[model samples]
Target: MTSLTLVVFSLLAGLLLWQFYRLTVACRRANRVDWGRGWMNLLDGLNRLFCYRYHRLNVLGMRLPKQGPAIVVANHVSGLDPMLLLASARRPLRFIIAREEYQRYGLNWLFRAIGCIPVDREKKPEQALREALRCLRNGEVVALFPHGKIHLDSDPPRRIKAGAIRLSQITGAPIVPHHISGVRGEGGVISGVLLRSHARIKSTSPIYPEEWGREQLQALVQAVLDNKSEDLESIAN
Candidate 1:
């Protein structure tokens, strides 16, 4: 190549790199992500891009404490649900996921890095609970889907599990509920991530365990997840 051509090519590459760096910084700032790891921060940027740009995810009234122990509960719809939550959260969330999903081929390492606690439903599930308790004790955020599995909004009525309520009662961490909708690939994991969606995440105010009984709290969470609550207002940051 000629010297002038080489110089022009180098300048164009430099400009592209500079633009990419700016974009990454903007993404991290928008997502409130500072994972203390370059690779993780990069992954967070990619996640923001996928959720915000690719899926067109519209997050409404979702805000968590700047620094504290909290439990985030959402309806399990598609595999993309976690991504939506993570993108909306200001703090790092340690997810309580199913063991089988956590152990998925090629994704286990990523899951572990993100502090995912795996529970075997048929086996000793309390093991995961203990781990989550420990995280909350350390003032970390733990997120889980109370419905246990992917139960769509149109499916038959199913009761949510009591783990989130119990955790809130034990740790004094408020339970933040969110409802997800508009996922194109509603059931499959890979498909959920790959397909384009006009996703919407509706977040409600945190439910403090001191305000209600166990059964009542469970019912409230279910109502919020089912989008049946009348006073589901978004909490202000």
Candidate 2:
């Protein structure tokens, strides 16, 4: 081969190897708190890299405690939101997803591999909630998109589901409010990449559920959502 061609091939090979090394380090860091789900960190690393490249994901307030169970509640926009959160989190996160989405053809294995708990929205969502609570009690993080499903019609102000708050009330797990924006698309990977938007994750201080009623929990959520709405609006304009 020509000298120029040989040089180009060597450069490409070295770059690929460097990326693989970085991915390995990232996986190890994320797996520190993973509850026997380190394998999923490989996928999360890849997804996070994709978001960093295409979506410009900026995560804030992610300094979670080293130990203990906590509930992560976020506004769901696209399917990618979960992956984005997983990518940004320091611990392995168990997502409570809709059963239909969980059982999507050819993707069920992927969901199961990540230890996602599926909820039958039509019938027994309570079962899923119970499972999530159990996970929290066992000192694992449970992530819930309290909107119940992806809401792409508009920005914030959408009603927050009470399941997350209810879980916290039962388990005394701190609820971490996560508000995201700029996760554009119809929950499709290709569309999200093509959109090339700047996504942001705004996480607030953990709200302990100790001695707090459902009404109080709901009020805190509303206040957080209102603030997110204003932040999103300012970004748009």
Candidate 3:
């Protein structure tokens, strides 16, 4: 590995290993799962160590509702997006992850400790929907990359999957669109997806965050894409 990767790798492994052991012990006193805020606190420190800038964007003048199980729809740019969001997440979040990353070495164990839901891509998507909704029902932030896969050609007007819409409809949870723009890097090859750039997370349009019905949710996503004007497509092209 390169020097930077080595440094980051060693740091992460050391922190994760240390934190994992400590949390395992601490969690023994708790119930089945350890959903304590302690993990969040540790993650926040990790963010600082990694120089993660946690900025809340209010482009559309959006304010997150003080509640639970909200759908955090974010643009997929890098593997680091989850870490950044989780570390900077104001409240505890339960992530919806693809089978591969969810099953990756170290990540799976870590995700479990931090409360992430692993999904089988080959399985029926309805199952993923259920898991996401269930997390929501439990009053946890459910994160999803509406763009599905990473933006190989994430030009403006990003093309997002319909899953976020589907979940919002089912749970009546407001779909919070959090846009992540890549700054530097040759896609995922160089380093961080969010290597360096301005990041914006906005949840405008609703206060109590009413869930959009099936038809409405689809239209809402379409409108977002429409307004974005396929910006990623153009840039990537």
Candidate 4:
């Protein structure tokens, strides 16, 4: 090989190595970001910019308690639901995502940067739940989709999970019921990039899980979602 060719290859290798090191450092810093620090504040600003500009997302009645930890339970419409909710929320949300998604090859760094907690659905989901509960107890906002999967159309108001409610009951954290509409896409990252889908998310006042039984809580969440969906539909029509 010519001496100049070797020099060019060495420069390219150095650049790649530098980029990898930066990614590694970012992942570690994301994991250790202090809860009450400004790091999350910066991220929240960036999130809002992305959602508002790219998806034309709108938020409504999104007031969470100013004092303590709260859990946001929303119906999943598409993969973009989390980003929509995160951007709309007043504070940074620590999302409880599936372990499989967290370990994705190229996007793992992004997930870690957002401080997402991964749940292993195949083996032990309880461990993930416990970690989420711990974060709640420490007064950090946690967000999750109780529908478990994307609920297209009206299939969501009926299908719900009790995990968010259970966590609220244990931690005495209020459950903020959020109903989202207009986030339908072909699904996945590439789909979001190619298809432009706007989002409309609405939130109800916090519901205290400790005050209600499991069934009652579930019914309340269902009612809130049904009502919110109706309002959004009427507006859209």
* Better-scoring candidate (lDDT), 1 or 2: 1
Q: Give each model's whole-structure lDDT.
A: 0.87, 0.74, 0.58, 0.74
On the 0 to 100 scale, the lDDT of residue 43 in model 2 is 66
Choose 3 or 4, whichever is better by lDDT. 4
Segments in model 4 whose C-alpha atoms lie over 4 Å from true places: 1-43, 59-61, 156-158, 184-189, 226-237
Once fitted onto the true fold, the runs of candidate 3 whose alpha carbons sit more than 4 angstroms away are: 1-40, 48-62, 152-158, 193-213, 222-237
Scanning candidate 2 in windows of ten residues, the lowest lDDT window is 228-237
lDDT of 4 at 136: 88
lDDT of 2 by residue, 1-237 (tens): 999999999999999999989878875653423445556656666676667766788855364556799888876666678767876787778888889888999999998887899999889878997889789889988888777666654544577788888888888888887777777675664575467778888878788877456777776765564455564444334
Expressed as tens digits, the lDDT of each residue in 110-211 for candidate 4 is 788777999999999998988898898888899888878766555524557888888888888998988777664734545654466677877778988766
Clashing pairs in 3: 154-232, 155-231, 155-232, 155-233, 156-230, 156-231, 156-232, 156-233, 157-230, 157-231
Cα misplacement distance, residue 130 of candidate 3 (Å): 2.2
Winner by TM-score between candidate 4 and candidate 2: 2
On the 0 to 100 scale, the lDDT of residue 80 in model 2 is 73
Model 1 residue 42 lDDT score: 76
Q: How many residue pairs clash in all the candidates, one count each?
A: 0, 0, 10, 0
Q: Could you give candidate 3's per-residue lDDT for residues 1-237 as a string of tens digits? A: 799999999999999999988755544432222246666455545553343443322223223467766777666665656655654455666777777877888657787777777778787657777777788888767777777666633455555678777677666777766555533442472365445544444333431225334655555554453345464234324
lDDT of 4: 0.74
